[model samples]
Target: MEHFSQTLARAAERKGGEQNLFNLVSAPLPEQQLLAQTDDRCLAIMTKVVFQSGFSWRVIEQKWQGFEDAFWQFDPHKLVLLDDSHIERLMNDTRIVRNGQKIKTVPLNAQFVLDTANDHGSFARFIAQWPVDDITGLWLHLKQHGARLGGNSASFVLRRMGKDTFVLSRDVTAHLIAQGVIDKPVTSKTALKQVQHAFNTWQQQVALPMTQLSQIIGLSVGSNERQV
Candidate 1:
């Protein structure tokens, strides 16, 4: 396998220079800041990601205020109390996307937030304390617990929340494949472990966060290609 330094250098060159490349990457939020996040906001973000999965993000962005208002700012206590009548009402509501399956995920995911908060004092604390070294495991946790929070949706939620995490974007996947870390979509436990091991090895070599390493790996392979 190629040393991570070589890939990082290539990325830096493409991004204009090391400093410029660093400017392009976002720092993970501090533990205190992460833990300070309100459960409402976390649920809102999760809801947004779930709805945006296969739809136009622009539409969701425009209607977000309506969503916040309709869902009582995504308060887990309020949302979890929503009955079937509310679901049916929302299906006809013009303010938000009306997909039945996606709309139903709101209450279920709210319970997920509530359950997580109940277990860990707060959902933010649970997310803040999750180790980045096993990000794929985190993804699995979300999938198993949160409604409609599978695969890319779960990953997007963490990324948008500024967690110290890496996404398996198209370029990242391609690089992983080239390095023999994973040969197909990282679905099975074995594939995920291989990807995690590769990232851990690269993290040790470069002493950087997995988020930055993931971006660098994407850049090393070049951009302009759609993310798989």
Candidate 2:
């Protein structure tokens, strides 16, 4: 298992392409990265993004201080203490989204976080149950629980706190295709299966072509480790 983990880490050092460092989809603005975060700071990030999603990130970025002040830094225990009077005050605060429902959802979501922490003792203990640790899973979970998504125009936010590295965007996949690292474009839901097959083929075919590929060559890309 250590070998497997080491091999996967080494294979991941190769970036998608030279231009990918600036690619829009893979390299998003602050909101996505901050919200997708999974550390102890995550509760505050998730709280801010829930309302921040209603407006463009540009707007949120400009007024984030107002939000910080408004929410008292998103302390879970303090937020749960908010009563009807607090809601009235928040509804008029221009610093936040000022939408009643989204405002209400904040304290409730914080309370949910508190409840989960109470039951599980910590957030890390909570996420360990599921095996699918993809970036999409994180963002989708947030969206399902009442956090907002930026409309189709601004940006596509996936969970990318960068703790894991396999959440390659559409552009990243295209670059891999150009490099022959992956097979042809897969536009359908079955794309994942095709990738799996192509990768297996890569593993079987790599060693026959060169002696240097025999568990050798520094940070090698066209080797068995690149297969999957």
Candidate 3:
């Protein structure tokens, strides 16, 4: 819950040989970290997670390369050009989770991202405000139109992709419980809010770019004047 409970912070404070489980988890998969990078990739990661919330992050991480590749490296220009056939093909692509509905929103969400970025200065600026009602509107429309999972958790992820306000990772959740933020191994609302608040503050204080495993793929995809 507390920002101090971040895996890196905990790893620094822990007085044991065995690595903290949270550290072991976060040290490798840096998907969330990418979302906190420059404004451009920040929104790209959010768009990806809009569908990734309900599924296993491992799957998300695994398919991330394919997602990046298929989406033209998350470039607005390339993504906005994706057609219905592309969406249909992705549904049959075994490399990624074949959620037909969620995959369908990728192009539309691209249009939305460009619209938001053009209107609000950057998609990053738009999402940081955390508009709950508007997300409900998006969810209602998505469900009616055929998206699989566009609920509160996914919406929260969309908001969080703009900032590292909350630790959605399970290891971080358990760490918080170990650190007294919760009595049980849980991620409570109060704790999440406090951590989010702290993250917002810290995010405002610095500009950190994420550099994780680029062995598979990179968010640095496309040649569309990326801001990050």
Candidate 4:
């Protein structure tokens, strides 16, 4: 595998300079800041990402207030108590998207948030305590427990929530393959572990957050229009 320094240099060279490249990278929030998030907000983030999946994000963003109102601002306590009648009503509600399957994930994922918060004091606490080096494990936990959080959905949610994680976007995956981290897209647990190990190795070399490292690798190769 190529050294991370080489990758960083290549990325800097491609993106003007180190200053410009670093400007595009976002750091994860501190543990205290992450722990400060409420369960309702966490559930809200999950619901937004779940709804955005396979759909236009702009449409979701435009209709987000409707979603907030329809789902009671994504209060897990209330959502978990929603009966089938309420779900049926939401399916016909003009406020949010009418997709029955996606609409149903709100209550299901709400239960997931409530359950996790019940055990960990708060859902954010659970996320804050998870080891960044084993981020794939956290992804697995979300995929196994939360609704519609499979694939990169969990990663996107975590990143958006200011957690330290590497998203396996198309460019990131392509860079990983070029670096011999994995031969194809990460699907199985084994492949994910391999990807984690590669990131961990690169992290050891540079001491940068996995998010920035992943972005650097992505910027090293791919379309210039790609954002970090």
Candidate 5:
């Protein structure tokens, strides 16, 4: 496999320059700040990622204010307490997407946030305590424990919330394949381990966050520009 520095250099050339490449990729928040986030903020991100799955992100972005209002700013305590009437109300509400199944996930995810908090002092703390080197492990945890937080949705949630993690998007997966990190899409436990090890190595060697490394690899493979 090529050294990660070679991969990043290739990406920088394609993106115009290193600065340009850096400008496109997002930086993660400090550990303290990440841990300081309230349960509401975490739940809001989870809800947004959940709703964005299999739907147009533009539509979700346009209706985000409505979502905030409908979910009472995603206050986990209040959301967990909502009854069937609340779900029905949101299902009929025009301001949001009005998808019944997605709407139902909101309260379930809210309770997940609260339940995690109840066990770990706070949801933010639990996530913040997660080691970035084993980010896929965290993703697995989300899939197992959180509602509607499977696959890339879990990664997107962490990325949106300023967590220092990598996403296995199609583009990124392509680059990983090209770099001989994996033979196919990351799915099986062994494949995910290979991907994680590649990222962890790159991170340690370059002193860059997994988020930046992931984006750089994606760019190297000509992936569409996105806010990583």
Candidate 6:
């Protein structure tokens, strides 16, 4: 395995200099800021991520306002009351994407937000208090408790919500494999644990957040023009 310093050096060299590389790395939000997010916003983000999966993100962004309006601004309390008829109506709604399966995830994930909020005061507070070193645990929690949150969905949601998380993008996974962190893609629990341990080791060496560390590793390889 390569030392994180070597990885940082290679990333800087590829991107022109350390300053340039540093500019691309964004820090996670402060704990208070993350905790300050409303539960409705958390549900909205969950709905957005669910819709964006296997779909064009740009199209989702373009139609986001429509989504916001159609889903009653994604209020968990309101969304949890949606019935089968409501879902059928949304299937034909022109505002948002009409995918039935993805549309149905809205109320399900709303309940997830509500349930988590009930336990932690708010969903944001729950995520904000989750241990960054055990981010995979949080990922599992979302997968187990939320609808359609398996695979990269949970990670993307956490990253989008300003929780410090390392998304296993293609570049990041390739870099990890190249460094012998895992012999293959991280699909199983054992593989994910191994990847977590590696990231934890790197964190001990460098004081950077997991988000930036993952970005640096991603930048060290792959197309230089691609965003981490």
Best by lDDT: 6
* lDDT (Cα, tens digit) per residue for candidate 5, span 1-228: 788899889888887888889888888899999988999999999999999899999999999999999889998888888889878888889889999988888878988888899999999999999989889999999998888898798899999888999988788888889878899887787998999998888887889998888888878886454423
Candidate 6: which stretches are off by over 4 Å? 225-228
Tens-digit lDDT string for candidate 2 (1-228): 122233333444443432331221232223344334443344555555565654676777787788778988777778878899999999888887677877777676676667666776654344433232233343344445533432211113223222221323354355347545557554443554444343334334542111111122222234323322
lDDT of 1 by residue, 116-140 (tens): 9999999989998888888889999
Q: What are the per-residue Cα lDDT tens digits for candidate 3 across 93-112? A: 87667887666666666666
* CA RMSD per model (angstroms): 2.6, 10.8, 11.4, 1.5, 2.3, 1.6
Off by over 4 Å in 4: 225-228
User: Could you tally the backbone clashes for each prediction?
Assistant: 0, 0, 0, 0, 0, 0
Taken over the whole model, the C-alpha lDDT of each candidate is 0.88, 0.47, 0.47, 0.91, 0.88, 0.92
lDDT of 1 at 175: 90
On lDDT, the stronger of 5 and 6 is 6
lDDT of 6 at 123: 94
Ranking by TM-score: 6, 4, 1, 5, 2, 3
TM-score for all models, in order of appearance:
0.95, 0.50, 0.47, 0.97, 0.94, 0.97
Query: What tens digits encode model 4's per-residue C-alpha lDDT throughout 60-152?
Result: 999999999999998899999888999999988998989999888988999999899889999999999999999999999999999999999
Residue 27 alpha-carbon offset, candidate 6, angstroms: 1.2
Lowest lDDT sum, 10 consecutive residues, model 2, at 208-217
Which candidate would rank higher by TM-score, 5 or 6? 6
Model 4 has a clash total of 0
Task: Show where candidate 5 strays beyond 4 Å.
Answer: 223-228
